[model samples]
Target: MTSPSDGTLVAEPRTDAWEFGDFAYGLEPLTMPPVGDATVSSALVPSALPPCNPDLVLFRLRLLAEGGTPDLPDTFTDPTDDQLFWFRWITGHQISFLIWHLMGEILERNTDREIPDRASLARLETYAYGYCAMLLYTGSCPIDLYQSLIRPRMYLQHRSFSGTWASDFVPVRGLFRGRGVARGDAPEAAGLARAVDVHKTIHDGIAARLVPEGRSLLQQTMKETVVRPSERTAILYDNFFMTLRAPVDGEGITSQLLRRLDAVASDVAARGLYPLGYGGDERPKELRSAEVAHCENRIGHLLHEVGEAAATPAKPLS
Candidate 1:
């Protein structure tokens, strides 16, 4: 491993983990395991990543965390309201990307089509709720900015761009969308079902609020029909979020998750998503409702199990 002369951490693309297939399992992270059998001394862990490194701006938080620094950006220490609004959009999407990716790994059918264990199902339920929380911050992006910058770009990229197009999302869509329930009437499955209900409502609410015009995305674009490129949409979605279909390891993502959760939890606790009169003045009227507020509270502050795990540094022991 080549070290940076100034000690800045350099991120590279990983081969073992893909954008959709690799999920970081712990809201409360488990112990970090070695990458392989041989383990000998170095605070810096080695990951055998290839040349086309996927760790872009979107993955900086996770990379920073893995390097043992505070998992958040330095400016986050005392952010202004304007800073909060802009950064929240970036961080919120990043968080949602991770949560969705993790959810995909949990719900994807195994080679033998085995059902996920009760714990994974339970985690699915929990993260379903967490994904909703992520919306509060993301949706908090000023309406003008969303319209002028985000939404227009989305349409320009692909009129039919949707979550259904996401590579990882395809595998887990059925479970969350009510088509596949692994355990018929079991409590674990039931919990996930219930969370799915809440998830849909929150998701739709944010989308509706953001796009009051109510225009539907195109069913299929001309290019899509002509090419029928299976992974095109998936690649587009991944690129939009600055994620890559690369290799990753369990211990790597898990430890990074704990650090990320801690960082998000700190931000949420220090000041609610919108800091009233401080940095943030107010939320849009549509998003200021009780329902939206509830989701905001749930994201970082109210997630008991997930929040607790973030309090400690979850680094791999040498």
Candidate 2:
């Protein structure tokens, strides 16, 4: 593994990494809808959206399924140091992906139920808006294990553990009973299963009260009942509803937001993290680091951009 400045590590990309190339390509020219002064009497009622807006949820799931195997630039690895930078980078990316997935569950529920009340929308918006901020933060800082570990501690000390979004999803170990993909599982099937488990556990817990319908939309998505995975991706692309709201008095908004974002970011990073030079590529150390960082940056930027865009209502594509 190559260590870089600020204790960051970079990993080499593999051939399979290109699986995400098309999705990545689709994400180019990403832009957020302007959060203008147009205030709806109620936060409900579907704000005007753009045609074919990017879906953070589906994009995130696809990213997670793909993992971080892409060929990264070489500048991120520093051999002279014993730091675990690459591990941290991957950990952060994974967390970002998970966070986006959870948020998707929230949006799906809100839209399907036609949550028409402004207060409800406000709560959802609170989460949605913070998600955007998180994306920006991740894109710019790119959390590592070090940051991940530290942030959680800090958040727990000051914030209320209840009412957080991820509090809904169950942990991966608890959800998946058998290891290795089933006979019919696809190449990415195992990873997708793990992702679904995570999504189901978390969303089921977090929005339990709000979505009183029982069984999260995430579960439905998995069953291919309400929406197919690919169709969910399109829905994610079309729906941009900010769930993060401004902190109210006595509300630990900052701490809550940070904790939730950090959790997902950390999880995703862990999933994608790989050791540098593990593949036996003869590429120069510095070049390899740069390549990894490039991929990390791409993932990070997409997370941030998607969050920003999701803050606004997505219009139907003509």
Instruction: State the lDDT of candidate 1 residue by residue for 161-211, as single tens digits.
Output: 565554555556676676666334665578777667666666776676667
Which candidate's lDDT is highest? 1
All candidates: CA RMSD (Å) = 10.9, 18.9
> What is the Cα-based lDDT of residue 200 in candidate 1?
67
Number of backbone-clashing residue pairs for each candidate, in the order shown: 9, 67
Give the backbone clash total of model 1: 9
TM-score of 1: 0.61
Candidate 2 per-residue C-alpha lDDT over 277-308 given as tens digits, one digit per residue, 9 for 90 to 100 = 22224322322344334433444443433343
In terms of TM-score, the best-performing candidate is 1
Q: Write down the lDDT that model 2 would get.
A: 0.32
